[model samples]
Target: MKACNERRVCVTGATGYIGSWLVRSLLQQGYHVHATARDPGKAQRMLSTIEGIDRLQIFRADLNEDRSFDEALKGCVGLFHVAALMEFGTSVQENDHVRRNILEPAVWGTRNLLQSCMRSGTVKRVVFTSSISTITAKDEKGDWKPVVDESSVTPASLVWKTKNPGWVYVLSKLVTEEEAFKFAKENGIDLVSIIPPTVAGSFLTPTVPSSLQVLLSPVTGDPKLYPVLVSVHSRLGSIALVHIEDICRAHIFLFETSRAAGRYLCSAGSCTLPQIMDIVSLELPNWISKSSKVEFNRSAPSIISSKRLLDLGYRFKYDAKDVIKESIQSSIGNGFLNSQVEFKV
Candidate 1:
């Protein structure tokens, strides 16, 4: 296998959750990393999280803007497009904001970025931090399809997709993947979509999305949660879960393995919300109320296949429960949470 060591890599959203981890992992693997954040100053915030300080260089890039990515992508050998607007909540004033946050950046910014990559001739390939959400779509009769895989899943209309609150992030993911594929096809870019399911894990680095909310999940009705994740309080079902480190390794694995192409699903296992709570209950019973309803509402009927990764010899350090539990414990250890779970929601 060819390691991307000595490779000059560019990661958008380099200061964010997945992007931060990706940056750190690349640095550890000996890749010279150039990362982008909307503000170079805020990019410093990520320094506390990354393990390797000497290998990372922060540059300014915003999805909403056009010209900044050129310099960041100039010398990089590969691109990891991880930035996306994942805001939730419903206010009429910010409706277009949410839509454009993802659409403009993904559709427009990504196009220009890919063009720059080809023009620079330094980019050999691009690994997009895409989601399984792209698999969602509406049927011709106006029915809903939440299933995502190597098949066609039409997203809700671009406008409604952003405002769903629970799953708006997927809207951007769908659009991002669509645009990547379109751009790849038109300009001949080698692009791979990383489809991860319910990521949970020990936070080797500080990341916003890799928080307890992700571990506790079943979050209050907000736009950030994916629609496919709507199940709460019910019966036997599961949400595919993978540790954050495992997700990061998957990103690196895909980049190294020549066979890795198209869409690869990164998953550990699935567990019901109650099952999840049960695991956490042993550690933090105080957080989940005994009266809380832990039912399965919108869990997928099928489990995602990680056989591709397994065949490629990828190993997960934690299973679903252990990963979720560790995330909670890590948060507590990091002072993000106390040992006692006082969670009310």
Candidate 2:
């Protein structure tokens, strides 16, 4: 594989929570970044977050449009394909909506983007942001202890059969990732995948990302909104988590390291529902009226190994406590939470 032009790269979904932070980090490293978004006008507003706006270029592109990414991908040596649809609401008619909104965009969009990359010829390496859903999509039954790592994969049939909106989202990720790897292999493109669990951090956009919403559920008093969290807790006492900054660093590390190949599981640690609730109760006692103590299903698998990334000599900067604390502080600072709320810790 040819060496990437270290100075230039393209990041899809550049205005999203993780994408925006990745763009900023790339810019801070003195790289000229070409960012793609569905609405270029909306993306341009991100200039307020990063200092080197002059080095950033915004392109108008849609995931459904096959040729929309051509212009943005031109002359880019590295590509970070991070864009995907995030549908939150659940209704009786949500299955069709999920198929149209989440599945098509995630799978088809990845195909179209890789096609564009193959045509561009300038792209030597691609870093794809996948999810842990691809690993743990099996039905929650029996005493099953699955060894999860880069080799683990969720069955497509299981993802397709489930009516649960959360599982549907997982299905979307599973399909997209499988298709991406197949395409990359056929075309002889160097590809690396980052599979993260619940990503928690501050938001770059005005709205909060879905992952952060899980952490904010108790305080926001809308636990039903996070069905994924409920499902994960019911099965696996706690879920693996990683900070946004740490995930972004992993992306950069994988891209820059020649030996980096295959998928790497990115997680700082796991947090139980009670541990999270206790932190919330200690920090913002007046915010919620419910008891801080919550029971967890201890039998479910909660551990996610980051040994592959650790072998690369990369160290995580935040743990479960730091992730929750920093996320709450950021939410409060950004006015996502009530200003009157007090946080003692």
Per lDDT, the best of the predicted structures is 2
Locate the minimum summed-lDDT window of 10 residues in model 2.
Answer: 137-146
**Mind sharing the TM-score for model 1?**
0.81
lDDT of 1 by residue, 1-345 (tens): 233334788888876777777788888888888888887787777565667777788998776566668778776768888876655433444557856654665688778777767776677788888764554334455443444245545445643634443355556677767888889989888888787766655554453363345445442222233233442111113566777778888888887777877877776876766566567667765564423343453444554566767777888877887777777776677665543345755
Off by over 4 Å in 2: 1-4, 92-102, 137-141, 144-147, 289-294, 298-301, 339-345
How far in Å is the alpha carbon of 74 misplaced in model 1? Answer: 2.2
Report the poorest 10 consecutive residues by lDDT, candidate 1. Answer: 227-236
lDDT of 1 at 94: 59
- In order, candidate lDDTs are 0.65, 0.77
TM-score for candidate 2: 0.89
- Clash pairs detected, candidate 2: none
lDDT of 2 by residue, 163-234 (tens): 554676667778888889999999998999998878887667777777887666756755455466766565
